[model samples]
Target: MDIQLLTRKIPIGISQCALGEPVRYNGGHKHSKVCTQLLGRCFDYVPLCPEVAIGLGVPRQPIRLVKSSPAADAEVRVIGVEDKNLDVTEPLMEYADSVVPALEQVRGYIFMQNSPSCGLRGVRRYLPNDHGIDSEGVGIFAQRLREHFPHLPMEEVGRLNNSEIRENFLTRVFAYDAWFRYVEDGQDAPRAGRVIEFYSAYKYLLLAHHQQKTRELGQLVSNARALEPREFAHQVRGGIMEILAHPASRKDRTNALMHVQGHLKDYLDKEETAELTRLIEEYRLGLKPVSAVLTLLRHYLPRSPHQFIHSQLLLAAEPAEMGFCDFH
Candidate 1:
């Protein structure tokens, strides 16, 4: 199936500021062309601003994560840096809790970086003395979002500047959407069978991400018959997310590419095999993108097609969604 034809717009969540909204504390927007011009073409962004949604108006005082107590389980509070007594942590958390239920339809989210309210990671936390900041804090709102939807693909827009990270995020977004659609479409199928089929379709894609985890997931799927329906689906989704969390190394990707090459080996002559091998080596060496070899492989797909190879999302999850080939 042409996955791009499956939908024109995939629902996604985004920080309002990242979408060029003037929702920042300083009444500014950290507009991302990647999100706005590139990804925006395919994503239906549900823009959110936790600070604003919590009744903190534009041009409000900046909030910082401050360690409030020295106790073992000390709570961090989002308080005004200028006026330490002005705490807004409770309100922000409450707002996140209230808004998350409405975001269930979103397949993925892009957070603004270094924001105390929206940064996905490395947001600075201030010590009570105000002498220094620790980089261990995650944005309060991002934390709650993760807790609510652990399997959803969420990344900070800053990190998407890296080609591999960008590619991985796009892959996960499309895969998550595809998985959701698969479950929705197969509502009447035996649960175990649906789980198996879903995993099967994503097998090669999983292999490209992580081989050991993919094998572990396959084992987990085999045991699905013994587990409850919801439990089985949860396990499968968790395993897939864990596998995709690690960026695919060149070695691992080469292994997967070679696996695909094996599928077309019988059809290619010696010269063709050498040329394909050279292209794969070039990709492994970073001289060429994986799309180059995949494009060649796809050109030959019609000559000798296999159901498994053709169904692999690794080949093309949503080529036209956002010009993903350019990311490679």
Candidate 2:
């Protein structure tokens, strides 16, 4: 596939603070160069600040999650730090609900870490007595959005700093966007045929993430006619996103790469085959990066005329845009 397809700006949601906006409680920005400079190249950001959206002005009082009782699952509220009486948990959730329609266009969302309103997870939670837990809370607004858009790809700016995590997140984002464009948004009604084709394209990509789940999904797609079209589509979509959610392990990736190599075995000479196998083993042993194997595969790709081999997303340059070239 032409890598240029991914160059078309993908619309994604982001915390305004990540974009260098002064939307935080202290009227400061937690500007992330990664969000604004790197990922921004392909993503057209739909910036949002739940705190500011909920009528909390810039330089507003800071809020923290406070547990009503010291229980395993206590009712946590976003309470004003200094003014104990002010609680905006419900308002934050309500604001998240209100933005659902607008956010529907976003394939993924990047949240600000450690935020009371926008943190994806691991925000600080405090006991009513004011003692704080190290990290045991999810921001109210982020929680609400997760509940509403369960399958939408979400990540924290802090987490995206890691190359592997960033690549995995982008892979999910592109796959999510690909599903809607190719299968769900087809001119005709979505059918088993389109779903199968879509799955075929992502087969090795999924296998690299989770082998058992990928095989199970293969069976699900095989029996697509047994379920209603909409239901089948939903199941397939959920499965694909879930599989891609796990970062592709080096061992599993080597396995997927070997599968790709199998397709080209008949097309390569003895020396070429041995060279490819050596590189794959080196990658499996961490002696080399996955890119080395991929580079060798691309050299052999043109010699193989199998369309299916060519169709694999794993072989395409498009994934390189997601930092797959640097994936270790």
Candidate 3:
């Protein structure tokens, strides 16, 4: 087996604190072993602390938003004032806004959870009129990142704790990186060969994951030769987005596993095949698709180099935050 084929490189942006940097509100860090250990090998990480960059020094004054609504039911934004006090946020927003343009290199970002300044989801906001709430705000920098590059895959470190969420995130990240490499990264023309090579490797994988759009996307790329470059470019990019919109789901993943099982009929013993078939059925019934398919693949893939490589390709192509382990 070629060692290089076993390694896949994905570019990711992570919150500095999650990478073990002391950039949290209290001069601490929320370390994620999954990111530092399991995923680190497969991904080339780019770490950032938006709060730190926005001039909020470690152990600085805690900031919160007094939302316009007294009921605390709307989305939150940070406000510098509390109890009719002073405001101080222009510098922060200015810095946050400036940092986003520099993140064009990142295919995905991992954010801190529940941070008033960096939370990717559900940070709190207070009502200054004493409506009595301060925990439902969006981190200013995270919000800006989403607004700037909605296409890039992103997730919170906390979300990675769930195996399925981790798997989904990793799947999107890897696919997004491939896309940037094949379509967006600098070359003026789409390299039809590389795109097709990737698609061919992923064709069954895409079908298994229930990405009907991805299958269509493969066909579109395969059929692009007759069109002019400018014409094909728009169609191809749009097709890629359409595929991305449908993150691999459990039902799709089960079908993918079953497809692989069908391909293995000539290889595994009757009893072994029966066991795997049962697991695939369990996945269809909602018994965790990642572990189920992986159990079968791990059992049979080692027996054939071709099957092994194909399995690895399907795995590494998945988003890290989508599942429990690095398929790569």
Candidate 4:
């Protein structure tokens, strides 16, 4: 596992305010140290302030999502809270549409929470009468972004405070970047053999997330002869993203770790095996983080030197980005 091979920085989309830019309506930044200090190290952020991008000034009037009707097709406007007559929905949506083309290259997105423009979920939406707020509405800009790139990994800086969600997002981002680079750098007609190898590398990782989904993805890859090169690649990407969307439970991860340990069992001595078992048990009991067990596994990775194990992203996935597990 050469660390240099995994050191490429993936391009990620982010709310400008989250990067500590003064783009908020109150003329202050929502400066997330997690995004700026930690993730910033592994990602090249493409920042966008929907409000500011739409020509809203600093210290600008706050906006809120307003539902015009109860119908599903009813128009929802991003209107000024102070002056209800000021409807900026068109401009906000327009800005979102305009920038989506550029966002195609972004592997992940980190949105500011509770923002009417950037919140990925749980954004407040008010009734036209201003009587109550609905917590189900997605931000206008975030909504468009999701519509454009549904498979791209997205999270609010707030939800990322949860270790599981944070880990999931980082894993998805790196996996997506690896897939993108492979396709972009490969030939016009990527061979089925190469796709099978890619799927093999991620097999254990996918198993940790969902065994059934992993099997199904393997079937898809195995049946690659039935589809064209581009189609097969798309299916593989979508399948990987879908599996990763589910959080990896402790039981699932322990199972995957045990499987990995089985591969190196012959190489490790009794004492080494006992020590590895202890660390795995610690992780199972929630006494230690996944990184602790992974650290030990990675130490033994070079000793055996199997191609399948060496190429496993599960072992080498974002070691530097794991520093985020310590922060909110």
- Among these predictions, the greatest lDDT belongs to 2
Candidates sorted by lDDT, descending order? 2, 4, 1, 3
Error of 3 at 193 (Å): 6.9
The residue pairs that clash in candidate 4, if any, are none
How far in Å is the alpha carbon of 278 misplaced in model 4? Answer: 4.6
- TM-scores for candidates 1 onward, in order: 0.90, 0.93, 0.69, 0.86
Those runs of model 3 whose alpha carbons end farther than 4 Å from true positions after fitting are: 1-9, 70-76, 81-90, 132-136, 189-203, 210-249, 258-279, 282-328
Query: How do the residues 225-308 of candidate 4 rate in per-residue lDDT, one tens digit apiece?
Result: 899887787788789889988888888888889989998998899999999999999999999988898989989988886788
Ranking by TM-score: 2, 1, 4, 3
Candidate 1 vs candidate 4: the TM-score winner is: 1
Error in Å for residue 276 of model 4: 4.0
Evaluated at residue 76, the lDDT of candidate 3 is: 48
Q: Which is the better candidate, 2 or 3, if ranked by TM-score?
A: 2
lDDT of 2 by residue, 133-159 (tens): 658788899999999988899999999
Worst lDDT window (10 residues) for model 1?
A: 319-328
Each prediction's whole-model lDDT (CA): 0.81, 0.86, 0.66, 0.82
Model 3 over residues 150-237: C-alpha lDDT tens digits? Answer: 6678888888888767766766666666666655457676666555555565665576555667667776877868777656655765
Off by over 4 Å in 1: 1-4, 69-73, 185-190, 303-305, 317-328
